[model samples]
Target: MAGHDMLRSISRTFKLPEELFSGMPRIEINGDEEVTVENHKGILMYEDEQIQINGGNAVVQIRGRGLRLCTMTRTILTIRGYITGVEFLR
Candidate 1:
């Protein structure tokens, strides 16, 4: 029974998404890691290596690496990165 429990734990570990360990934001990372923004209208300001995010009413999805958000406002978001894919689900 103990072995079974251990196996279950191990299996659960694999179930975790790769992004979770990579510090991948559940929302989005701005300026290619320069900043981080949440999905709920949150903004992040990045200068040097520090990151800041402001909360509001917006959703961001980040996938892959390197993102630069030049400007973001209500209903409009500007970003630059090696964008692989982007979609608006609303």
Candidate 2:
């Protein structure tokens, strides 16, 4: 089997989510106040009104007011503020 296919098979056998092995970004939003992104590549832009994240397959765009970074790690980040919109651009 192909390398990727093999990895996928292994992941399934272990009951692991595919995103963990696929490098895809996972996003979670809470109400209109916060957003958490996992497996993100990096931050492309940051501001009080907007932020851009480098997702593996797409660019994550966040627009808001009073935006601030609440937490950040190598693969995960949390944004807090009055979130107005979220978009994924390919």
Candidate 3:
């Protein structure tokens, strides 16, 4: 499916509020340093590490040292790390 469609589907399945998913998460990678994720209802940050993922329903995975996730609306999630993959699944 399309990326937007996929996001919508995941949002619906997770029962996320409308306002929560209004903005897409901003994922930034800085060479081999650190990754930054912003604009999400929730935020997760990790330092000096790598991230990898397979898939999930409403969870974003990171394969670094560790991670910090914060949710502003208790719905949206922001994850920051050495992200390698982001998958939205059922």
Q: What is the C-alpha lDDT of each candidate?
A: 0.43, 0.91, 0.44
Candidate with the larger lDDT of 1 and 3: 3
Q: Write down the worst ten-residue block by lDDT for model 3.
A: 50-59
Off by over 4 Å in 3: 1-22, 43-58, 66-90
Clashing pairs in 3: 42-70, 42-78, 43-70, 44-68, 44-78, 51-63, 51-82, 52-63
Ranking by lDDT: 2, 3, 1
Error of 2 at 84 (Å): 1.0
Model 2, position 5: C-alpha lDDT score: 69
Candidates 2 and 3 compared: the better one by lDDT is 2
Give residue 89's error in model 3 in angstroms. Answer: 6.0
Clashes of 2: 0
lDDT at residue 70 of model 1 (Cα atoms): 68
lDDT of 1 by residue, 1-90 (tens): 455455556656888643333322344434443333333345445432222443322223433345566676653445555554433322
Q: Model 2: how far is 87 from its true place, Å?
A: 0.7
lDDT of 2 at 7: 72
lDDT of 3 by residue, 1-90 (tens): 476676677778899853345344445556533444444333333344533222222333455544443333343334443445444333
In terms of lDDT, model 3 sits at 0.44
